[model samples]
Target: MARQETQCVIHHSKLTSYCNVCGEFVCNLCKQSKYGKHEGHHYMTVTEKTNELKEEISEYQKMITDKSLKPLRENIHEHYLVKSRLDSNCDELTSEVEKREKHFIKEIQRASQKLKNIINGHRLEFSPGLASRIAQLEDKKREIDSLMKTCENVINTGNTYEILEFSKTKKSDLNTTHSSPRQVPKLELHTPRSGSLVGDSFGNIRKSRAIFTDEIKVLKSWSYDMYIENMFTRNDCVWISKTGFFVSVKPKTAEEVERKLCPVHPSGFIVTTSGEIIYSVSNEHCIYKITPALTVRLKHSYPYLPCGLCLAINGGFYVTMHKHGADGKIVHYFNEECADWLEIMCYRKGVSLLKKPIKIVENGNRDLWVVDAASESVIAMNSAGKFKFEYTGSRTCFEPIGICTDSRYNVLISDFGHKMIDILLQDGRFLTSIKLQPLGISRPMGLCVTKDGHLCVGQGNGCVHVLRY
Candidate 1:
């Protein structure tokens, strides 16, 4: 057979140059050269174009394989991270749940033990009456034990259905029946005023003793020449001497007067151990320090309203405020220059101010005793405002207006409406009510127990009455 003649055919419609080595088209003589169109070209017939394309696609199969693997690797890594986070969260939740379960189980066991003790005590006291009830109680106890077991099983299995069934059964068995009547034992008793124990030590008793009676003594009443004007009672006012008193008038003015103290409105007053009179004027919003020679010396101001005043053991005084809903604050003035004093903001740690704190007095133990007039209670706290105890006033008609403490640590509370002075122990126990002999005390406002145990009370009648115990 003769060799077929190879011809070059140009397919211009396809926009492709053909090599003629395999009987395809050649546009120019340069196409025949090995370095030109013939270089690395696999010549093919015109009908083999589709087969050549199929061969070219085989080379790109590996690239497609690599592209498909990228998403699968990324998805696997993301799944691993998510599963790790989920496992950590589940472990934390399981730990918390186990701790809570242990605590609740301990609490329930303690409650069960207490109930058993109570039942045993009842059986010992009334064996005949409790014998029948003890059998029923045992059955209840067994039921509770079974329910607890079910709850434990449910917790271990984490089964909501089992927990719900246990809860329903417990509610039906434990809550449907009425418990037996129990006799509550008495704790304390009181004696009558006949100096005899009237009942068994479990009844309320009235004792023939006085609360603030020891602090009531008569003082020498010497009428001064000064007419009684409007006196502003503050916590810091002090009697400088027998004739001179000092008080603060305003933020800028402090006055010390002889023969008579000026009528400056004050919220509280106190006498220093050295006989200096210091007064806190709430309306003026200032604390004034006065001398014996009728001279104004030191004055200090505060941002809040001032009410109760008491001198601390360190010569610095504490002033309680009347600001409603506000925590009581105490400002301490240490030095004579008024520059070194420290104001402590102690609202959370101390005796909280109730409605309106009216008076404050320091006891021998250095504890601060405050009288809340609005709440009608006497509250006791340490120097730093730590709550100690409280004495509630008489509920029927007693209103504690003025308060003072004696050297013997007795608290004297003056009631304006009842016109009687209630004596209370340092622990807030009621001692006795001292009825005024001269009866017409319209409103008793101020009170002070003298060194000789005389109760000097300031009445609304423009006169201070001295009461003897």
Candidate 2:
């Protein structure tokens, strides 16, 4: 190809040289600095500059041919591929929505048909007149209304993540449900054998109670060597076995369980929001974190033994530990590049709070539930660690040990003395008890409410019982 001649825009003159001072194209006339602010400017002859431009243009064309063009074409094609794949997935999602809608409609229709059959039977046993029939119709109407309300609550109130996460449990329920009218087991509060009027330190008794089942099905059990200390369950059940090894029924992502040495009996563990297991070792005065990759390392070490720990949604770590002298204190720590234990909040010893804090848990509202051993009470405090109310349990919480909160923010305390797990309201009211007598859950040591809403109770024995309410 013929080389195009360059022109200087300012003078409208043929660019016969390169100006070094101004770093721009200039004709020979503009090269004199004293004449036009290009005083004594360095200039290259037109043939030398033309040769340099020709070399640069040659290199640029070679780059486009050999390197840049193929990748640019591939990037353009990749956009098309991604768009096509996303459209296909959108179609699949629409199909899934249709399937879900049909399934719910069929179930609703079947339930309405059952109600119709019941009404027809009631018509045959026509002993009661219009007034009684009207009452029965009103009851049926209420039942239908309640069903609609429950369904709406699940759909509307539940977060997108929780609804998707509970899909597995919902599918299991759907599988068990049939056209036959299934009888739901009635949940009732059993009167304690002592028949004593039970009240907590706060004086607020339970307005609503928890239900327990006599039949405890041990889904899986194993023989362990020592006390099964604490169990955490999310997608699977995790516990430090008696042998000091972490055992899980469903291995998360098939990662090998790392036998990272913690305290022989670690005080407690919090499965972090990121799925890492952070355990507090009372003996070592250290906290260790185990990653999903099965890598265990010392995450943080403290001066005093960290007896219990709870993690907030914002990744703040609240710990209850054994202080050297009187009672242990609650320490709020933030784990950034390192574990920075910000400061000790409440460290006083009185009949009211902070005496040998054994176990600790945080509720939905960030209230701290510290099970104090010496005081024999669960000292609940607000987010600021201010004294809210001390719950000495319904029957003075017998040897309260492990503490955990459910999805509803109800606190579960394992009473070793009473051989029961006492459920309490977050505000320190006594809710109900799970008497471990018949279910073989004696010595309920470690208590945790699973993400799937199952209560995993670790016993003095090696076995951990997973119970549903």
Candidate 3:
């Protein structure tokens, strides 16, 4: 074989100008075409530029490596901290579960001991008839034990045939026992033990009779004219004075035929806190604040038709608007001049604040409670309008038109349709419903709980009913 000739690597070189700073090649003609001002600019050959670029790249990589380690160190530290907190929480939960399990086991043991005592007491009264029943029960127990043992063996050994056979036998035995109705013994039923009753002597009886106090006297009823007449009737909203008195208002049309103005028509009567007669009014869109001297003052004008009003914990009054908005429109106003006012009413997600807001009351926590007649739900929100929870009213046309909270945080919602009241816990748990007697509450509008815990509800019959729990 002929010896292979060595081939030399030939490198191409041309008159190319390279930028000294950026290492880009430029033809000699382009470099020569530069103006007089740029002729002195630093330029280099391709080989020199390449070597300079390699040195700069190595330095740049070192700089990048120095900067990248900081975030990596912080991330590792954060991961360790999170892992430690998770481990601590897991240990705490495990301990809590174990403690609960121990308590549950002790409770089960106590129950078992109590049951054993009951069984032993029954055995002590066993006669010949009971002995025959016990023998039958023992035979049934033995049969059940044998069936259970077979089932366990089949399950452990994964034997389908044996499992099917045992299941069929058990089913047949159950069917036979179920077909034969067993006769139970008619033993004397034991009466539950009661504490000893104490008898009162003649003198004690007389002393108890003497403890009767003075009876409450009823107040005389007053006649009041219907101040609201010939107007589109909206609702009746009422408010009590600081000294526990009643004041009501409703809407009435203006006499001017061209100008159909809806004004507040006042009812001229008031009631005392002790179920005594006071005065009343039939006004519209205006809040009547009663004085101690029985004089009514128009505190503020309601933007829309007002249905209910209640005093908040901050002394600010909350009034519900009964006006129907256009379809798909929901707007809430804090005051009558909402259009001119800068501050807008707050609202939360998933809550339609303006949908038939009828009754507004403040709870012990100073949170506002609203009864939406359209939605048939009672909604509770914080002062800042953050939604807390909602209690759905009954489905049977029990429209909740009045709502109030007692001192114990028990919510009382008045259903105008059902002519009754539903009580609920603060957490929206249903407690019970109270049905009003004589069933003529045309519309239960407003509710208030007195300082003595007496619930006072306003009905459409121009009367307020008081109930004591």
Candidate 4:
């Protein structure tokens, strides 16, 4: 069977050649036509073009294998190796924990039994004799009491003769002396020296320290015309909340791919694990969640104005809020269903936990890091709402606004006043600082740690800087 040639729609002619300049298959008439679109374009036979493309594809295959696939495969293999080692180390730790648990249980049981035996010995040695002595003393006391009462009644009601007779009869009994008071023996059991779960006596777990350097590498930067108040990364893209809307932009191309306008500007926003945007408007009393399809829904209504938002490790979230014209800034924890579960109000002695919390983030260890701009510090608390530590910058003019935590659980705070990102250990110890001024990152406010460990910083000057930490 013979193959039919392709016909050109414009001229109804058989297509026999390809135009390199126009990048289209052309008929002989197309090139020969004086007034045609491809009149002066270079032409080549279809077979020749096919052969050229085959050669180019062969080169591309080699380039891909050497430059891309090979390196990716090696990296994947390294990840698997690391994962295997991690699993083995975790198993050993678990076994060690179990062994320690068994040893502690046995020791506790032995100590309890010893104390019980001492108590039983004390009871056997002193109980019966003490009971008998008490009974005999009680009988003697009753006899003396009755005699005195009879003597008093005769003196009060009878005549002098009755009083004298009563006195003479009671004199011998009254002269009898009682035994001196004796101290009772007491059984004192000392509590055994106990160890704490978090104390060094029991053992402790330490996190892997994040390796850092003073060199700040800016992997990508995007500039916008609108002011970026808050931004969070979702995969390769980031959703930035501007004045009255949220825009999703690709940092690589600096392209605004999607935009959703809001009635009010958000005080803070966060991208959840499920690709939902949870934000709070400071003037409003409710938190809102925007689904992936940009459908907005009310998440929760609270008594105070909600602001900073963060997702918890247990599929919950934290929202920092405060009453209008009030100083008692508090935080609320909500479940995955957006139902309020816990409210952190004050510390010991009714001390305020946060003065002006502008942002919040949860680290890998479930510690909540809140940026208290009014306090000029980053307050940290455990997952159970116990205050951990407050990290006020070592500098005098510290003004922290944005906060996020890295994989190592180290808290990262963007200091707008210092124009730098301060890194601290989970215990609130200042580890280091990344000066963003040198890298052209001014007024760094909103922060999000990308999945690949890059730090996405949204600055006040309409710039988003992605740093490789």
Top of the candidates by TM-score:
4
Alpha carbon deviation, residue 54, candidate 2 (Å): 99
Which residue runs of candidate 3 sit more than 4 Å off their true CA positions? 1-307, 322-353, 438-443
lDDT for model 3, please.
Answer: 0.51
Please list the residue runs of candidate 4 whose C-alpha ends up more than 4 Å from where it truly belongs after superposition: 1-212, 255-257, 292-303, 324-337
Q: What is the lDDT of candidate 2?
A: 0.66
Looking at candidate 1, what is the lDDT of residue 285?
A: 68
Q: Sort by lDDT, best first: what order?
A: 4, 2, 1, 3
Overall lDDT per candidate, in order of appearance:
0.57, 0.66, 0.51, 0.72
lDDT of 2 by residue, 176-256 (tens): 532234243443544432223222211221321232244444454454566665766656545454455566554223233
Residue 243's lDDT within candidate 4 is 62
Could you tell me which 10 consecutive residues in candidate 3 have the lowest summed lDDT? 226-235
Query: Considering TM-score, which of the candidate structures 1 and 3 is the better prediction for this target?
Result: 1
lDDT of 2 at 360: 80
Mark the regions of model 2 whose C-alpha exceeds 4 Å error after superposition.
1-221, 251-264, 291-303, 336-339, 347-352
Q: Candidate 3 lDDT, tens digit per residue, 1-469?
A: 1222121112122435575554445544444444222244578866686788899999998877778877788889999999999999999978976885676556556656665665567655568987888898778778777866765455434334665677777787677763543767676534322111111222333343333211212121111232111111112222332123223322111111221111333222223233222221223554454343444444344445555554434433455555546211212333322322111132556545547665566678766777776778777876545677877775566577667677788888878777777777777766666666443344565566555545565655545544544
The TM-scores of all predictions, comma-separated, are 0.46, 0.50, 0.37, 0.53
Give me the displacement of residue 335 in model 3, in angstroms.
12
Q: Across residues 353-465, which tens digit of lDDT does each residue of candidate 4 receive?
A: 77667677878876778777677877787654568787779787998877877778888888888898888888787766788888888798888777678788888878788
